[model samples]
Target chain A: MSALLQVRGLSRHYGQRIGCEDVSFDLHPGELLCVVGESGSGKSTLLSTVAAQLAPSAGTVRYRQRDGEWLELGTLSEADRRRLAREEWGFVTQNPRDGLRLNVSAGANVAERLMALGMRNYSQLRGIARSWLERVEIDAARIDDAPTSFSGGMQQRLQIARTLVTQPRLVFMDEPTAGLDVSVQARILDLLRGLVNELGLAAVMVTHDLAVARLLAARTIVMQGGRVVETGLTDQILDDPQHPYTQLLVSSVLTT
Target chain B: MTPSYNFAFLDEDTKRMLRRALLKAVAIPGYQVPFGSREMPLPYGWGTGGIQVTAALLGRDDILKVIDQGADDTTNAVNIRRFFARVAGVETTEHTVDASLIQTRHRIPETPLREDQILVFQVPEPEPLRTLEPREAETRTLHALADYGLMHVKLYEDIAQYGHIATSYDYPVLVDDRFLTSPSPIPKFDNPKLDRSPALMLFGAGREKRLYAIPPYTKVESLAFDDHPFEIQRWEHRCELCGSAESYLDEVIVDDRGSRMFVCSDTDFCGDRRAEAQA
Candidate 1:
């Protein structure tokens, strides 16, 4: 199948400092890709640039609409961009507080996206939000409860539900399981994997952990210091370790 | 009066900036334009917005009028009037008809404003969705989308709970069918005057750093559901002092008992009516 998103020569710079440079990729439908890099590796910059959250300094990110036409992402109007983020694309932030609207109830956060999509009937919106909460393993009754009241793991799952309830065509997840307990991380990863497969979601997930990449992504790209250093099948990259940074990463995790 | 300050106590550059913002505000009709709010001689909520707007718009020949809750004798009104009389050396008036510029808090004049007059309101809050949605970022987006379902649900729930929409004052209105604006704290009675009036209406919230305008002859709708229409407050008693039944009445306690007497909230209106009665 043709790619759903085409990004070429993408770069973002912060004055004298480099954020990311020359990042190019094509993402297809029903594919899950993981971007693995450590702190300040430009993996996040690349993700945000491609997602059109942070504008690219020197390249293009084109999204192919469902009608089979390519539209330049950078040129979309503010209204159209918001609409796309609400209806077609979902972004899951690393910190749950950043991803979820903390002031509103867990139900409203889920229903808000539905509301942004033009659903007006209160009961129907609440019903769909409740079902999605249940699907995310949050108690249906806790739908009215604020995500702040949830445990860290539950908050992450609620964030997942808020993003996925829109049934977005693509999702950009920034460390979906970064700061949770090992037990919590496992459960969230399991929930995310199940949903992505069942819905045939296209996702670009950024994570520092090789194990997370192996667990979620069919293909993986390794970033180092504002550049993608390696790209290949997840198993081949994780098991063989081609780049010096990838070898060091695998060895450090193996040693620890 | 000693004129120690610049014209209207504002620098020419500041006035020019304010004038530009005012023009943008008039063009947009209800969208709030952010401006650099200056610290004035008065406190924040005590008509700073109205002061800034009046200062920017005041010309040497403009007759200024200031009123608080429809009373020119009130301390806030008296001080604001004294402020302009001293700094700008402009003539001040108590009569609503003669004044070219009226800076008000919580009331519009009983006299219908003319095409030459301008009304500036001191606004504590500029966003109508603010009470419903606390976040400024979210409210901006909501205004952009023209999606006010949150407000509808709140009002609808009020109807479901109380058998009526219980809000009495500072009622919300959709301005120019585009921006849902707060018509300041003016009671809903003054809302009708805002609709298709010949005079230009400007609103300023200094503490909030925002200003907006409703040009002459703009469509302003007080928000309401189809089944439950918008309604203004009315009192049973006529003005005991002026014997005018049409004016907005303020209830005054009598004899420290349950008995009460209603008086006209508009001091000028009541005074005019009493003079005409005596004649």
Candidate 2:
């Protein structure tokens, strides 16, 4: 399968603090790849750099456009990056608050990505928002409620709804279920698994949790101190970890 | 008294136009009413919208409070408060409970506001459909017809593409189930405050030439679908400074080595907490 996204030698740093360095990966069409690491291991940095939220210190992020051409994300101008971010790529932050505009209704949040993609009919927007909300397992009657009123897990689901509303080819999520309760996290992971399989969309998720990775990702890449230490099938890495960090992570989850 | 600028630093004509717009905003609850906006002494992207609204609403008896990111001592807030004190000759207070009218950019005060208070928002763009549609002429038609089909398609697309929606700021909302509006740029954490708020809420976009409002007791809904309704951000992390788990917080970089602290965004709230501790 042709890769939908290609990253080469991606590196980023804030002065002496190394955000991420010498990272490289490829994502195939309809693939779910989870980038797992510790808090300072540069997982979020890699995701942000690919999403074009932060400029990489060095390296290239190549996105396969609909026209069968690859566009270097770093080389694109700000306007182009914004356009791509809005129309072609979706990014969900670690914190649901960071990923959604809370003051707007649930419908508006879902509609915003579509609006960015140039959808304009209100009746159509409302209908689609309602359906998407139902698909995410939220009540349609609460469509107008502020995101602030929803629980942590619900907000993450809503954040997912807001990003996916645009129908972008690729989506990036950073620690999406980090702060949610376990039960809520399970529901979100289940929803994400169902959606990814149903839509056949390509996704890159950054997380510190191995269980989350196992739940939603088919492929897993482990990073330690800003370098990729392990890469393989999610089950393989989880069942028989290769890297010391990966083993530690798997053991830690099991112990707790 | 020596004079430095006109009444409230805004020319009389601008104030009059804002006053007219304010009246219209009050007349139609939760509707984004357009007005002839003028450039202010401050930059367009700053608090020109809230400054204009404050200029229009200022009276001898009115007590004004200006806050940015929910703090009165913030430089922008101080400058705005000074502007009013110098130009309009109105008293300025840091207390949310004391102020008759509060002009805010990016945040709502922590205290529960009374019905007598008025909250004016500084909006960069007033149209909720602008991001979805981009063209003003087309979005106006969408609002006029109460059409929101484009918004739904966007959400559906999110499910199809990312397995979720991917927006974080300036989220759109449905007002009174009739008009779709932007609730300024307050974090999703602040969205619940707009629902059935006792204090009247008004929005002004100086650059966009629009004004809007939500009357007390009016139904304001953030747009969402039934299955994936809207949600706000909550943190397991509490405010380090005020020890407040409920209040909105500002993430602060405390040291050069990257140590971080979370402080209450509302200065009065923090100060009150400090005072209580001392007592």
Candidate maximizing lDDT: 1
User: For candidate 1, lDDT tens digit of each residue in A62-147?
Assistant: 99876788889989987777777877899999999988878667777777677556565655766798899999999998876767
Summarize candidate 2's per-residue lDDT along A78-136 as a digit string, tens digits.
Answer: 66776787777888888888788775678778877776555545557778888999989
Q: Please, what are the lDDT tens digits per residue for candidate 1 over residues B229-270?
A: 888888888999988878899988888668989999999999
| lDDT of residue B27 for candidate 1 | 97
Candidate 1: which stretches are off by over 4 Å? A12-22, A57-59, A74-80, A117-124, A235-256, B1-21, B33-40, B55-64, B84-100, B109-116, B125-174, B187-193, B206-210, B221-279
Error of 1 at A145 (Å): 3.7
Worst 10 residues of 2 chain A by lDDT: A114-123
Residue pairs in candidate 1 whose N, alpha carbon or C atoms collide under 3 angstroms = none
What TM-score quantifies how close candidate 2 is to the native fold?
Answer: 0.53
Model 2 chain B: weakest 10-residue lDDT segment is B159-168
lDDT (C-alpha, whole model) for all candidates: 0.88, 0.82
Candidate 1: Cα lDDT at A110: 78
